[model samples]
Target chain A: MKEERKKIILILLISIFMLSFCLLPVIYMVIISLSKNPDFLSAEKTLRFTLKNYFDVLSVRSLHFTDYLKNSIAVSTISAALSVFIAALAAYSITRLNLPGKVILLFFVLVVSMFPQISLVGWLFKLMAELGWINTYPALILPYIGWILPLSLWILVSYFSQLPKELDKQALIDGCSRWQILFKVLFPVALPGLFSTFLLAFIFAFNEFMFALMLTADHKARTIPVGIALFQGLHGEIPWGNIMSAATIATLPVIILTIVFQKRIVQGLTRGAVKG
Target chain B: MLPKGTEKSKELIEAYSFISPLLLFILLFIFVPVVGTIVTSWFKATTFLSEKFIFFENYRLLFKDVNFWQSAQFTFLFILVSVPIELFLGILFALVLNCTIPLRGLLRVCVLIPWAIPAAISARIWELIYNYNYGLLNFLFMKLGIIPKPINWLGTSLGAFFSLIIADVWKTTSFVAIILLAGLQVIPEELYAQAQVDRADFLQRFYRVTLPLLKPAIIVVLLFRTIDALRVFDLIYVITSGGPGGTTTSLSLYAYKYFVGGDFGYGSALSVILFLIAFFMSIVYVKLAGFSKEIA
Candidate 1:
């Protein structure tokens, strides 16, 4: 009994230690947010909690987080919807269609999926510049679709392929066209797969920093990630409180989405990863 | 008039049609641009857009560039430092979680919280924690009487490296853990139970049973992580931006600098080298994951 008690204490201590390492950083951010000491630069010691930073960050006339939030939502939703649809179509074709070069194309998608966003940022920047698309939603939306297509396709392909081929063939035998069969039969079955991939892709695009940083110079096209990064108060030093507030607020969408579709999203990501 | 066994051609065409939309965009965005990047690497670009072809001078100059070498070395070092350590932590955690315990679900949720939090956001969070004044690390050090003064966590090379590693390990260790956990789930519990009946102790059972079963999962996690870590960008970009005078400038950041800074030729050469290096290492890991199955 004494040995068992010792074992239990050891486990409790180690788990607490591990949890502290994980928890402290975020907890510290919250602490910094509430503290009134703006002179964190000077390294002073005064602890006062105030609502001033939250108000400043939230006020439309001040930080305009409300407008930025609206824009981010608009871009993220539209891009996510369009990208998922395109990826679904592509994935179906790759998995179900007995087309030429399927192996080669699948391989191609794998290789392309690994292409760093930085590579395209340079040329895409130039492309957008020439197309008069600087500071435009389409500039971001189109590339986001292109960028995320591989992940979506890969996920849906694995899920779609796992679906019994007989379901497809049976629908075809019932005088249904291939496209109709896809919409009515396979689509419903693969809905979870599609939804999960979309969530994954959307979160990534939403959280994306580099392209949003380079391509969008103005609030019209700015994402929350970029907006939060370039937060300036017409002063030199960064406002830790406001930055923390914004950072906290920015993660809400991802958190909400994760809750809404947590089951499918986690499964989809793990499944997608396993296939590769 | 088609010959018998022409069903192969027929099926192939259908496959092409199915994959056409994905293929079309891939060609336009990925394949073409990659080819352009490669071709563009050979050119003497007085301009970012100027296509006039040059010789191997770009590659020649790339080898001589000290910044390139420094960044490459640092990038490689970062992967070397972080990957094995994180993998070990991941496996250890996974092993703990694999045991039938009360509140396993709660612990699993706890494990995921760190990885789920954005790396950049968490890095900022840690920066606050690593503050020379009232920072957790410094405060703890002071309490322990380890140091008389707060060490500048982000102001020095080794300090920044350790900080960055902590953040990376915090944010990504869960990813490895999840994968290993999957492998652990796939393991037969019977094996452990049987070994216990044979009077095996913890160490003996672990070595005789658990570890051999963990091999495939470990390899999978290792391969995935090595690739991901090799392409380390956002975490580094957010926290340090290869700071403390380029001490942490990774290969990806180096590639980003040259490529976006309009030294496309040099950047392309570097990116190609980066791709080759990552690809080679990925192949090594895949093989290490027991390619004997494939051979058989």
Candidate 2:
């Protein structure tokens, strides 16, 4: 009983530490966003709560905060959907279609994933410039799809491999083409895996910074991260409240997705990183 | 019924067709850019200047450049300092989360919150938290009497370095924990029960059973975190902008500055150097982790 009590106390203490360590900055962000004075923690001032920061951030047309949000949503959604569909095809081939050099291909993709973004951004900048596609959605979306493919492929491959080979055999015997087996038969059963991959890929594409920073010239193609990063006050003073509010809003979609699909995200992340 | 050789070849063609789109995207976007960077490094490829072939000149300049060396040094030190701390905290969090604790799901969601948010956005939040007068860290430290006055977190070199470290840790420890938690879950309960039967205490069990069993996962986390840390850009870019005398500029950011300035040759050269380092580290990782063998 004493030992169990000690263990319980230990677990509770660590849990508290984990919660505070993970949450305090996020809480601080929200607090500053809501406060009229960002310097409320100073000796004389206190938190004077208001919704002005959020109102200014959202309603102010010049800020282009909503435009950034819209671009981010559109870019990330398209990139994630296309990346997953393409990776599913490749993964289907690797797992079921007896593709030659499939192992080599997987390793190649893994190596590509580790290549630093700096290595690619310079040339991509020139390419986008030459194509006259700078500050456009396609400029960001195409690279994002490529960047996201490896993780999607890895996760889906693992998920697909786990499903019995007999499913493919049965589908093949039904006079189904390879394409039909993948789309009509396999996809229905792998819906959860597909959703998980889509979620992870969407988060990745949404959070991507270097690509968006280099590819997009302005708010027309700029996503939220770049937008929030470059958010400056019209005057010299840093608009803490407005920046925090924008950040808070920007984080909402990903935060909600993560919390709701916490288990699926964890599974997909582990499958991509560790299972190999 | 066995298919004929031509039929087998036809299936191969079909399989290749399925994989072609993915291959094409990666080849164009990733592979071509990488090769282009490599090729451009051998030239005087500035925006205003005429492109001229100047093989190895940029690299020679890089060798003699002070800022390049400083950024390289900072990048290495940042990796050395931050990766170990993240690994340690990640293990602790993973161990806690692995236990049958109350609010386990809530604890997980809290952990995932940091990892979920973009580093660029979170660094802005950290920027506020590390503010001189009204920041959370300074205010708390002063109230607790840990320091006499608010330190300029992003103003001094050491302050900026550690500031970036703290923010990076906060943003990434969740990832390490998640990866390690997957590892911890795969650990058999029987081993712990057996350890208990052998009269092993908690610490003993962790050292003897858990550590040994979790080696592969630990290795995976270490490699992933190290490679990721080596390319540290977004957090430092936002928080300090490599300020306080460029003390915290990573190789990636340093190269990015050149790219922004339209000096693609030097930028590509810098990128090539970073790519080589990362590539070398990955080779070591592949060998150490035996990834190929495991997948096969």
Candidate 3:
């Protein structure tokens, strides 16, 4: 009985430790963002809390906080939607149709997805510059779609494979053509899978920084992560309050979406990885 | 119900039509740039001069570059130190979360939060956490009598490296745990039951049964994390910018410097080396996991 009790106590303690480790840095960010002092390190003795930092960051004209947010949304949303759309067609073909070289196609997608953005960013910059598309939405969107489509395809393929084939047979017997069966039958059935894949792609594009940093030159096209990282002084004095506040706001949408769709994302992740 | 010959040909055409859009985009964007990196590495070209292809010269120059060696060494060191630590912590958390714990759902949700936030944002939070004077770390250390003077976390060589590692571990260990947890959940209870019947303890069961069963997941996570650690860029860029006299500059950051400085040939050579490392690691991972059959 004593040993069992001890085991339980140990488990509880470890759980508490892990929980705190996962959460403390984020909590500290929130605290520092709200703290009255602009310099977080100097305000230890009598800490004051206020929302002035939030107001200051949101109101700054040069920071372009809203512009960063708008651009981030536009880039992530369009790329995610396009990647998912393209991936859905490919995935349906790979999973349902009897196509030659299907296995090689899946393997190719897997391999391509692993290429680091650094490997491609140089040529990408030169190409974009040549095309006069630098700092444009397509500058980021095209690469983002190319990079994210493979993973999205993998997830949707795994999902579409698991769906029962009886539904396809029934639709075919009812005189549905191939396109009609895909659009009217499989697409609706795979909606949940599509939603989850879209969310994952959106998160990946939203968090992408290297490409965003290299391609975007101005506030008109800069995404949130790069914007926040470069949100320092013209004369070299770091603005801790504004930086923290911007980070907090920037991270909010991603966190909410993740928590809300955590189950679907996990399912998609495992279905793609474990089977392969 | 199987289609005859003519119908099968029609279906193949339809499938090709469905896939063509993605195929065209990937070829133009991904495959072209990939080939361009390799092809551009041979030439030392500038906008002012007509391009000249000098074979192996760029690679020869990179072989003599000191910054290249330092960044490569540190990138390898980072993978060596952080991946094992993350794997250990991840398994422990996965074990606990897999058990019947109170507030299990809440803990799972909380753990995923760190990974959900953008890497840049997480680095920002950790930068403040490692602050010297009014930072929480120093305050806690002082209260506990661990040290008298505050440490400048990102201002020194060793301090900056460890700070980057700690920040990375904090943000990414949860991802390892989530993947391992999925592995743990799929493990059959029958094996553990049999071990218990044979009078095996928890540690013994873990060693004898759990480890063997969890090999595939472990291999996959290791591959993903190591490749990711080798290409460490965003965290360093945001937190330290590979500072303190470039003590913490990673391979990617080094390449970025040359690329931005318009030394395209040298930068392409560096990128090519990084690509080779990534390629080697993926081959090893797929071989270990016996994934070739799935493709063939």
Candidate 4:
């Protein structure tokens, strides 16, 4: 009984210590997000609840919340859809096909995707300027594909390899061409991978800041994360309440995605274990 | 059945055909850009550099750049400081979860929240937290009587770097925890059962069984953290823009400053250096992990 009590006590203490920083800090952000005045930051009083931030941010004409959300939704959705489609098709081909230099191709994809985004930001910045592609969706979209391609490829390829190969053979025997076989047989088998990759890609694209910050100069191309950052430096003093609400609103999609995909999260965790 | 000889050729062609489009995209996008980077590193090129090669001046200038050196030093310091702390925290957390703990899954996911957000977004969030005026950090410090005044966190070098470190630790320790936890799970329970059976203490079982089994995962976790940490930017850039005297300028950020400031040649050279550093560190990690002997 004593030993069990000690174990429980230790676990609770460790959890509280861990929570105080990692999770509590985030919770603190939420609290700040909900508070009315900036002065509440210094308030020691408990449960000083206010909905003013939420009301102000959710107001469409108020602080560009509507604009930011729209851009984030449009850009992230398109990016995700395009990436998953491209990645799935590619992953299917890489796995199902016995292409020449396939081994070399796979290795190259791994290195390319892992190529630090910060490394390419310069070259990309220069290229975008030269091509007059600055502040455009293509600027962010193209890079997003390059960034997420390797992982999507890795996941779909691994999953595709494990699938029953006879499904493809049967499709071929039944007079289906290669494209038909991939679209009909292999692609369907790769649904879980497709779903998860979509969510992952969307979150990544939405959360991207550096490229968005540099490439896009205005709200037209700006997504929520970049928009939220810029909101701080704009229009006299910082709009702390609106910034918090915008961040909270921006964070909602991912939180929902997390809850929905909690089942596959474990599988993704183990399979995509950090690759060197 | 189809004849064997013709069938093999057809199979090979079909495979090539299937993967060719994807291959072409990879080549045009990834391969061309990387090659462009290398070519630019050798040539004195601007954004509009459709001109001649000036081999190694970029390399020469980069070699003597003082700010570049400071950035490199700061980057190395950031990694060396942050990676071990994150690892120690990660392993410690993993040990807790790996043991018989209640609400394990709930706790595990909570740890992943910081990681799940983009570094850029999280950096901005931390900016609010670190804001000198109307910032929670200063508010707490004042209440606790830790300081006489609100410290200018994002306004100073040490302040920015420490805040960045705190954010990163919050963001990524879960990555280490999950990886280490996976490693922890693989140690046969019977070993622990027998250890307990033989009257071994918690510390002994961990030191004897867990640590040795955890070596490879720990090495990989260290590699991941160190590589990412050395390239730190989004946070610093968004928060301070590497300001208050460029104290927060990382090697990658310096490379970026030159590149965006339109010194493509010098930026590319710096990039080449960063790549080499990452490659070298990864090789050291692989060697320690004992994955080297298996390499071709």
Candidate with the greatest lDDT versus the true structure: 2
**Descending-TM-score candidate ranking:** 2, 3, 4, 1
Which residue pairs in candidate 2 have backbone atoms (N, alpha carbon, C) closer than 3 angstroms, thus clashing?
A: none
State the DockQ of every prediction: 0.38, 0.81, 0.63, 0.42
lDDT tens string, model 2, A148-206? 99999999989998989899899898889988888889999999999999999999999
Candidate 1, A164-194: lDDT as tens digits: 8889888877878667877999889888777
Residue A257, candidate 2: Cα error in Å is 0.6
Superposed model 4: Cα runs more than 4 Å off: A1-4, A43-52, A58-63, A166-176, A274-276, B47-52, B145-149, B282-296
Off by over 4 Å in 2: B1-3, B293-296
Tens digit per residue, CA lDDT, model 4, A70-101: 87788788877876777777666666665566
Chain A TM-scores, all candidates? 0.89, 0.98, 0.95, 0.89
Local lDDT at B190 for model 3: 94
Best by DockQ: 2
How do the residues A139-258 of candidate 3 rate in per-residue lDDT, one tens digit apiece?
999999999988898888878888998998899889998889989999898899999999989999999999999999989999999998888866786777778888888888888887
Output DockQ, candidate 2.
Answer: 0.81
- Name the lDDT value of residue A238 in candidate 1: 64
- Candidate 1 per-residue lDDT, tens place, B1-296, comes to 56857956765666666667766776776666666666667886535465667778888988998988998888878888899989988877777767666777666666766665555666666666677655678877876899888899989999999888888898888777777777778778799789878987767887998789877777777777777777887777777889989999988788777755777677777777777666566556545654333210
Better of 3 and 4 by lDDT: 3
Compared with the true structure, model 4 gives a TM-score of: 0.90
Worst 10 residues of 1 chain B by lDDT: B287-296
Poorly placed runs, candidate 1 (over 4 Å): A1-11, A38-46, A61-64, B1-14, B46-52, B282-296
Cα displacement (angstroms), candidate 2, residue A244, comes to 0.9
Cα error of candidate 2 at position A150, Å: 0.6
